[model samples]
Structures are given as C-alpha cells and as structure tokens.
Target: MDDIVKQALAKWPNVPHCTGWLLLDRRGNWRMRDEAAQAAGAPGEPIRHTALLGFINRNYEADDAGQWFFQNGPQRVYVELGYTPFVVRLAANDPSGQLTLTDQADAAFEPSAVYLDDEGGILFTNRSTPARVAVLHDHDLDLFSEHADLASDGRGGEFRWRDGAVLKLEPVRKSEVEKRFAFVASPAAYAATNPDNASR
Candidate 1:
C-alpha cells in the first residue's frame, strides 16, 4: 500500500467503495469502464496514461470477500476481471526460463503452481502469501515453449523435460478455473472466500 493512500484512508475512513468502474482485460491491460460500457457488458477504454496506470497498479489490492480493487486515495475502485486475476509471461529467453507473474493489478508474484487448461493455456499461481492464480498471455505461449526446456511427451496432456516431470499436469475446464483457483472472474461471480481452502 502507498503512504498517500494510507493517509487518505485514515483521513476519510468512511468513503464508500466504487465498483464496475475499472477492468483488467485478459491481455494484461488496465481499462476504465464508464456507465455505458459497464452496462453494455464489455471491456471499456484502455487506460494508457503511464502515471495513472502506475498509481493504480501500485495501490491494487484484494479484500477478504475475494473482491479485487485499487485503493484510489480515499476510495476503493474495484476491478472487474476479464479472465483470471493474473497474467504471466516468460521473463527471459533462456534455455530453461523463468516466469514473470503479474496480477491484473500489476503486482509481481513468484509462480508456485503451473498447469495447463483444456485448450493448452498455461495457468500458474504465486509462491508467497495470498496466492493468486493466473493465465500465461497467449502471445508468450510460443516464447515460453521455445525457451522453457520443455517437451510434450507422447501422451495426452503429458509433459517431460530434462529435470523429469516438473509437474504431472492435466487439462482443466475454463469454467472450473475460478473454483480451482479461488478467485472471481467478475465481481458478480464471487461466491465463497475461504483463503485457507484456496488452491495454493
């Protein structure tokens, strides 16, 4: 949390939170949704202001109710997720590369769990506290494969590499992603929020 935001919260502790005003799109872009855009049920205008984006990304946070939001000074601008809460990309083009995991809010995390979706989409989570599940950006999928030191064995959804099976991953349905990862794709999708039971 930023110091200015903390001061604002302390000064105006009763400010109501704002929702449906911001969005984190599937490709890792932050968007601002207006009333019409929010009602139309689609992504809003992409926020390209570098300073504003930096502030939002810096103050982003999630509540105990599984609601992700940006602490905009005194008020909370809740984010509407277009996909999972996170998006990861290959950090380097090494023979066996590492991942750069960032949530919709742009906070970095160390990937702790790596899996694939039914469509062969990569899914991962953080190693630290409050783990958030995320999908690897599609544009980086080929880049990941090229340098990840990975090879798909002659088996369905099976992967093998020099270090043996890094993970015995299987494909999972997109519909089950939220439940499997303990996150809300949209604000309205938030059901239960028991952090203890959230997939680590």
Candidate 2:
C-alpha cells in the first residue's frame, strides 16, 4: 500500500466501496465500466491514462476474502476480472536464454504449475507465494511456444521446462478453475449471495 493511500483511508474512513466498475482484461488492459457498460455486461472503455494505470497497478491487492481490488485513495474499487485475476506474458532473457513469466501487475513469478486447455490456452501459477493464476494472452501463444518443452499428455499437450524440470499438471476444466486454481476470475456472479466466496 502507498503512504498517500494510507493517509487518505485514515482521513476518510467511511468512503463507500465501489464494485463492478473496473475490470482487468485478459490482455492486461485496465478497463473502466460505466453505468451503461455495466448493464450490458461489458468490460467498458480501456483506461489509457499512463499515470492512472500505474497507480492502479501499484495499489492492486486482494482482501482476505479473495476479492481483488485497487485501493484508489480512500475508496476500494473492486475489480471485475475478465479472465483470471492476472494475465501473464512469457519473455526470453537475452543473456541467459531463460524464460520468465511476468504478470499483469508486471511482477515476475516462477511458474510451478502449467495447464493447457483444449482451446490452446496456457495457464500458469506459482505454488508458492499468493497462488494467483493467469492465462497467457492468445497473442502471445507464439512466445509461449518458444519457451515450452511440450509433450503429449494423451488428451492435449503439456509443458515442461527446458532443464528437464518435470512438474505435475493435470488437464483442468475451465469451469472448475475456482476449485483447481484457488482464485476467482469472475467475481460478479457471487456478489449477491456469497461475496466472500467469489472464487469458491
């Protein structure tokens, strides 16, 4: 949390929490949902301001209940996830020739679990830290192919690291990702009945 945001919270402790107004899309774009867009079930217009995007990314966090939000000064703007809470991209290092995963928030994490969907979607998450999972953007499939050591998993292909690192990964169902990945990609569905169990 930023010091300025903390001070704002202290000064205005009763600010109302906003929901269904912000979205993080699959391509790592921050979108602002207007009233019309919310009613139409859309991700709304892309927020293109560089400073605002940076502020939101810097203050992005999750509550104890698994609800991800951006602490915008004093008010908490809950995010509506378009895919996963994070969207990660793969990049190859020039010196080491090693691949790394950087999330929508621009933080790199070691991928511990990798799953490939029938639609050729690449899912990855670190079993350590926060356990936030991400789907590689469709545009980056080529980049992902460059790093993945793919093998036949009987159904679809599975990924293996370059150094013969073998990790366990099952064919996970997209609908059952909440149980399999432990993070909520869609939050609005559970907002009325069980806000806290958004991911569950």
Candidate 3:
C-alpha cells in the first residue's frame, strides 16, 4: 500500500464505506477501489478518471492544527465535530434512507461554513454559485459547523454567508455517472499507489 493510502486509511477507516477510496500512484494515474462492491448488487468497478483526482478529492483534508474538511467536488465541505473522535450520522435520499455513522478527526485547513439537516446530512452552497444551495444527502454537516464562528441566517437549514460565491450552476447525479466512471480493484493498484503517479 502507498504511504498516503496507509495514512488515509489509518486516519479514516470509514473511507472503505465511502463512494470510493482511491490511491494516487507515483506516476499520476488514479487507482480506485469501490467499497460498495463488498455487498450484493453493488457496482463492480474501480473508480478511474484523470479528472476525478486529488488527495482531498474524495478524502477528508486535515492540517497539523487538527481541523478537517470533507471534500465534495471543488468545495471543501465542512462538518462540525466538537472534539476528537468526531461522530455523526448520514443518510442519502436513495438506499432506503439508511443512516451511516461516521467518525472524523479534528484537523484544520481553510475556514468555511457547513450546515446540517435534522437527518445529519450536510448542506452547502455551490462552490461556483452561492445562491444555489446543495444538500449532501448522506453526510454530516453539524460536525463541521459546531464551532463555526458564523451564525446561520435563521432559516430552518444552516447557512453560511458569502462562503462560495455563485458563478454557474450544473448538477450531475452520482448514479447517472456511476457506470461511466466507476471500476473495481485491479493489478493497476500496484502502479497507481502514489498521488503524483495516479494523475498520469
């Protein structure tokens, strides 16, 4: 296993349950493993896409200061978990509304606002468009907004002010692209273990 993968796995064991857990190889080609495949009816493929690549792409970001961000697309989706061993529950619109619990570690990166719904999912504005709100169905926004210095706009849902400004809005559903991009583990895993190489 690559050192980064080892570190990420050690840091976030829940990774195995996320949409995908990919390793960036020394050459820059992405190596992905789909955890959903472990169960029945799960897609059978490894997520390989040069465009969908980044250390903080699908993985959480943590700085030495102990703050973290749950990256979604181009935005660093924040969650609020008071102290170490941050725990939160998540459930998506699909999948029968089953809730999945996640435990995060405290690590800082950039300061941003994160919102949570009663169901424990995350809510945020589009990175390119602040006016357009997005709800990450199966995520924990409360964990990222716990200590947020900013206050919500008094709407039932959490809010952030001018966090991610609006530019243009285009939405893509995960299920729509699941087959076009997702893949299963392969021998490529050997060469695509380093983030730099994974990009190639």
Candidate 4:
C-alpha cells in the first residue's frame, strides 16, 4: 500500500467503500464503470492513464472474503473481475529465449502449475498458500503455442520453456475456475450474501 493511502486511511478511518465502479477485464485493462454502464452490464471505458494504472497496481489487494479492491486513498473501490484476478503476458525481452511471464501488475510470475481451460485459455498458478490464477493474454497464444507440446487431442500436454523448465498441462473447466482457485469472480454479488462486507 502507498504511504499516502495509509495516511488517508488513518485520518479518515470510516470512508465509504465503492462497488461495481471499477473492473479488471480479461485482457488486463482497468475499466471505469459509470452508472449507465453498471446498469447495462457493460465493461465500460478502459482507463489508459499510465500513472493511474500504476497507482491501482500498487494498492491492489484482496480481502479475506476473496474480494479484490484498490485502496484509493481512504475508500476501498471493489473491482469486478472479468475472469481471473490477474492476466499475464509472455515477457518480450528475455535474453535466453526462454518463456517468461509477467502479470498485468508488471510483476514476474513463476508458475507451479499450468492449465488449459475448456475455452482454450491458458492459465498459470504458483505455489503460494492461496495461489493466484492468471490467464495468458490471447494475443500471445501463437508464441505460447510454439513452446507447448500438446497431445494429438490437444486436451493435455507439456509446456517446455527454452530454459529447460517443464510444466504439465491439465484440463480445467471455466465454470469451476473460481471455486478451484478460491477467488470470488463477482464480488458485488458475493457481498449480497455477506452484507457486512458490502459497500458502506
């Protein structure tokens, strides 16, 4: 968390929280949802400000209820997830020609497991106690395809990085992803059942 944000929280300890006003899309875009967009179930406009994006990335966190949010100074702006909480892209500048991954937050990702979803999305998870699941950017599918060794059925395979690290690919159901990964996909709806965690 940012020091300024921490000071704001200390100064105003009970600021209201917000929900359904921000979204993290599947492609890793940060979207700002207005009232009309929220009512119409739209993804809203993508936020392109580099400084704002960096701020959100720095303060992004998840609550014990599996709700992810950005600590915007004093208020907690809950994020609506389009898919997984994180989206990863194949790193472009690795000198060894090995497959490397970086998350939307621009942090290096080392996967302990790899999965291919029913919809053909590539997902990666690490060995953390409560693992984070990140989907590979669709645009980088071709690059990933070159490194993956798939079965004749393309149902299962192995990903071989040029650096000699290998990961076995497994099958995953899209519907079961949230439960399997222990992440709440729609935190607004989740809060409906646990109203205490809802916006103030």
lDDT of each: 0.70, 0.77, 0.32, 0.90
Model 4 segments more than 4 A misplaced: 92-95
- TM-score winner, 1 or 3: 1
Best by lDDT: 4
* lDDT score of residue 129 within candidate 2: 72
Q: Model 1: per-residue lDDT, tens digit, 1-200? A: 89999999999988876667889888888999999998899799999999998898888778776667889999987788877776665555267544355555556656555676766677776666777777888887776565343335512343232234354455667779977777666663333343443322
Per-residue error at 47 for model 2, in Å? 1.3
For each candidate, give its TM-score against the true structure.
0.79, 0.86, 0.22, 0.94
Give a tens-digit lDDT track for model 3, residues 101-124.
Answer: 222211211213344333334433
| lDDT assessment of candidate 3 | 0.32
Q: Show the colliding residue pairs in model 2.
A: none
RMSD (Cα, Å) of model 2: 3.0
Candidate 1 segments whose C-alpha is farther than 4 A from its true place: 94-108, 147-165, 188-200
Residue pairs with backbone atoms closer than 3 Å in model 4 (clashes): none
In Å, residue 66's CA in model 1 sits off its true spot by 1.3
| TM-score between model 2 and native | 0.86
